[model samples]
Target: MTKDPTLKPYQLRQLMCNSAQDICSKGYDEESGWGIVDLHGAMEQLEANYGEQLPFNDVAMDAYYVNAVNWALKNGITGGSTSTTFSPDMTCTRGQTVTFLWRAMGCPEPRISANPFADVVENDYFCKAVLWAVERGVTSGTSDTTFSPNAVCSEVQIITFLWRGLNCPDALGRSELAAGLGEHYYTDAVAWADTNGFFSVTQSSFNPMGEGIRAKIVTYLYQSLGRRQL
Candidate 1:
């Protein structure tokens, strides 16, 4: 809707499927790409967002993380790595992930507990974030004495944090990975994720221990924002 801002979603679907009036094919085919455009048909069919655009030069118009990044920025979750770069593929730290979630939840001040991690200093950027997370049970830290704020947050950890931040709701059904998966800290989180339509049909298993990238992190947040009250 950027161009006209008046076109409805159904009109856009019509434009995608009925715009093409194929001269070469009797029916839709892979080679024909639906058909050729019928501008008249599109004219017959026919509806508006935020600081949806980011200043990051690397971000494309069609990037999947667009809404997430925009939502994050509009709510002050991030300012990018710099004025002109989002670095969407960069690995996100545990500290950054918690901070993102904390910001998304409107930056609530921690009502209880002090910084228990020896590694987390009072002046650190993630210091308050860690405190809020600990008070809310979003995480317990890597150990009693270390927050490991700089550690690479893996995919499962991100899911677990998000789940706990929402009070660890139970899933009604088992995840597709239920049989192959063993018990772990994030098992229930993964199951809840699956119940919420987070995985694709072919995605039978997840690389839970793999590093979480900025793109995936934002995508998950965006999807959660859509599917859940949080």
Candidate 2:
């Protein structure tokens, strides 16, 4: 059977808002001081105003933001300050993002064996968590030899990590993935992501080369945890 076209922008926004509300109701209280800014609004405005400026920005907020924040808040993936601000626009560092995902997955904290990166000292708090991610194959850093813990993670990086962490199965074949992905290092990542219904290349190309925005990362994580409804 032929598939229907993707949901319109408004419909996607409603889905996100509903999802966010459900998540907030599920014991994930909005912090007191931080402004619980409407990610839906931010996402919508970002798309309506900046669609042509960026690739990922073209997707509707409803399609992505509510789900992302819902999952992040519910799973303790992101803890807002007393002010209740999520700081969604702030660029996420590799260490910070990985820790959030680790906590969300209920992964245990293991002892650090050694500092793999020359720049990351053993005494660093993120050292063990970073090591855990590496050992688990959730992340492999920029290269075989370097972790780049301080680097700001992009939208693609975080989504790929989420996909790996969830152990989503791969797509049936190379043709199932978007064209040109066969040559990407994240070919398996995209294939697995698509097969699992986490996303679609037809609706929006995975853009694996792009950086992950905070809202998008949160949405993918929430979906990975199977908590999109709440």
Candidate 3:
């Protein structure tokens, strides 16, 4: 089996800082990572807070995982590839990403009938969702009529989508959100993202245009849902 890399305390702190910043800039609430109640943190808290009295077991853990999975599934944010697994660790594809956001936006189910992308066939599950997002300016393909449906989504890319999906609400914009976030091109998007508490930057000089990872994504989503640390 492959062993996971062991990070030094300082390195782990840096990673958490980066993760927190990234998510906060995207409109999530900024909070200290040490005591933040993210999904993993929530699970650990459950174990610590109720383990002595509750019948916690693998079954319970499975139940919690399934609860999140079912919620996402019902909202069209996720779908089963097998009988009982969500494959949560798998990298999300662009199509899946768009679908997830669409569902997160209350599954608007747009009325459009045709997809702008030739590659996205009419019968494809993500066709309408992709079109809806594109038409609403929530996203644009890598090129005209070519919505790389199978491509794995990047963290920055997901943040951009989330920012737009929220209609660029009055949270923060790039210029005022953080300094040294790469070039000036993404300033507006970054500012909107920042004010909304989607992402954060530590050291007061970190770049905001960098890539995001799965942990950051999950954290941001959990925060966006206003989950508490019980």
Candidate 4:
């Protein structure tokens, strides 16, 4: 491409965002502001961070989670529901979230010998993920004998999983949207996630018990990766 090539509106938006990430506060969310930038910086930083566009039948070019899906695909975190479909709106399961996080962390081997949950068989797909999560304090199963991997994951559940995956860091601050939050095990996790811009579906309110669909889960994982400095 030429140095002074023109860009469409969506292309321009992506370029500007990726460029802002180049100069913004370290691991800070977008509300921190983009600071000052020029077309030169934007040009140089184009696609350097977000990577090239991907081919997903279910994901749109301008969807908020496009970057997340693309990044997840590139990093071997997911391969979509099929060769050309992502099934972004599918309800995410506890097993799927654990698997995604496990893959994002490079599919490391768990440090345990015996399987704790009868439901999480060694031959199952999420068995290793459950084990790895257990070793890291990310989860302790749904019960003494059941991992309940098939359970539908809620927004609070996924956020708590991610928070625990990061060793439960203290929130530097809380979002104003967190004012009326009810007392629950996930209250602190939601606060931390809100502070870091995890829940992108709504800014005015949060449904703590809402279903954690696939799109939201991937976006949260992507944002978590950014907070981890890549």
Q: Give per-candidate clash totals.
A: 8, 12, 27, 0
lDDT per residue for candidate 4 within 1-230, as digits (tens), equals 35435543444553454445434444223434434445777766664644456777789887878877876876678888988889988898889889988876657688896897988888888999999998989888888888899899987888899889877888869666555676778888888888876755333346888888888887887776655521
TM-score: model 2 vs. ground truth? 0.59
Q: After superposition, which runs of candidate 4 have C-alpha atoms over 4 Å from their true positions?
A: 1-51, 201-205
Over 4 Å off, model 2: 1-63, 122-125, 141-146, 172-177, 200-205, 227-230
TM-score of each: 0.73, 0.59, 0.55, 0.75
Q: Residue 176 of candidate 3: its Cα lDDT?
A: 50
* lDDT values, one for every candidate: 0.72, 0.57, 0.52, 0.74
lDDT by residue (tens digit), candidate 3, 168-228 = 5544333454454645534555665566455552112224443443334443443344322
Sliding window of 10 residues with minimal summed lDDT for model 4: 22-31
Model 4 has an lDDT value of: 0.74
Model 1 stretches with alpha carbons more than 4 Å out: 1-52, 201-205
Top model number, lDDT: 4
What value does the lDDT take at residue 74 in candidate 2? 45
Local error of candidate 3 at residue 57 (angstroms):
12
Error of 3 at 125 (Å): 1.2
Model 2: residue 11 alpha-carbon error in angstroms: 18
On a 0 to 1 TM-score scale, where does candidate 4 land against the true structure? Answer: 0.75
Candidate 3 yields a Cα-based lDDT of 0.52
Clashing residue pairs in candidate 1 (N, C-alpha, C atoms within 3 angstroms): 6-47, 7-47, 8-47, 19-37, 19-38, 20-36, 20-37, 21-36
Q: Which candidate, 3 or 4, has the higher TM-score?
A: 4
Among all windows of 10 consecutive residues in model 2, the one with the lowest summed lDDT is 26-35
